[model samples]
Target: MTGEDILYPPRASAFSWRIFKTGEIHTVSVGRRKFSADFQLVFRLIKGLIFLTFISILVTMIALPHMTIQDIVVCILAFMPTGWGMLQIAQALKPLVRRAGFWGSVKTLARGYEIVMGLLLFTPVAFLAWFPFVSEFQTRMLFNQAFSRGLQISRILGGQRKGRSSRNKE
Candidate 1:
């Protein structure tokens, strides 16, 4: 052990932290040790493959008016992740909120719920109400990829998708 080692900590993580341009909470690193030489390249590869599939579906849905039943199911399956990610973040923050004496955790979760769900629902509401409707396949595929990949930690921290977004009226 050298005296120099005490001040400069060696990088411990296996992955590199990719900073968000928006300065969101930086979910990519969990706000911890950001750089790592070790990484699960296999998992990364798999994630990428899955994401590509998702994108394919989304494009197809937007291009086609009628979607297959599979497309609809895929879309719903995809959104499952978004819901799961939001729930996980809210759950994680519950303890912090209570400890801070800001409010009850339940209240925090509820408030978060309203905002997250709203944001998530924006695309659906708009697609249903206005604009050319994407095929059920594409819609489902978009959500499928999103949910399957999970939300980035930064998103939770930044309070992104906090509420439904307004769509441009076409």
Candidate 2:
């Protein structure tokens, strides 16, 4: 056995098997090592839930002539976690933002622009919300692209690429 293998025995590899809480700090155990982070796994799940809620609400709003009081309340509640998750994700990415230098600053500014646009949607000036909304939406899409690019780079650097399937290769 390699010295590294002796130092760290093989452990469960599936991150999906674990449950994480939203409020508190927790440790993720990997073989003999542990990691702690400000944003827990639960927030990631919450973010996904938020996205689903958004799509559902949009569809429902479009389908219905008018929304009931209950529908409004539910929509508000569903949207709360989206704002929370966005803040948490931004907080979690602070270190990476610092490490990325100039491009990071641009991303940070884009995030700020998104927040500003979100706030503008609530103001009397919201008549122009469409303009800012497009900018905010584009910023988010680009930011997501950058994040995925970073992940791909990290995977390549770490030697963890899964080879293409036969169909994909062809």
Candidate 3:
């Protein structure tokens, strides 16, 4: 056996498997090695769960005024679309960020813009409600940020793309 083989026992060769007229062979992956497809399945599963969570939060955001936890829970949960969702989207875009060489910088900047907007739209209300001592200037700044951030975060969470408006719009 080669040194590499001694260090890591060779896994069963997939091609070595006998393909009879039968449907398939149930071979469990024995060694510590996990196939690349397994990793893909796991990533997809995580993405699905996050999507479900975002949908639930969006529903909550829409169906306001009748929930039990209004003051804190509602406020915090409301930002799920913007704060949590866009951050997740930015993370998801890592591969895309790595790809397009010429457009990478521009797209990455756009992604950052989206995340910032998401924070602006959703974070302030929660902050204001939770933290009592925020000054007027801070509030206005937060308000201004939210207008753009809401769109950014929304787009991050699988919503359509939204660009930031001019300062005059704020």
Q: Write model 2 residue lDDT over 1-170, tens digit each, in one string.
A: 76644543322111111112211111112211222254556656555665675567446553553445565455445444554564467567777745753333334434655776688566745555568786787677878876766757667755543444544677
Candidate 3 C-alpha lDDT tens digits along 111-149: 655786789777977777665566665767778876756
Model 2: per-residue Cα lDDT at residue 5: 47
Give Cα distance to truth, residue 55, candidate 1, Å: 0.7
| Superposition error at 38 for model 2 (Å) | 40
lDDT of 1 at 75: 49
The superposed Cα distance between candidate 2 and the true structure at residue 139, in angstroms, equals 50
In order, candidate lDDTs are 0.47, 0.47, 0.45
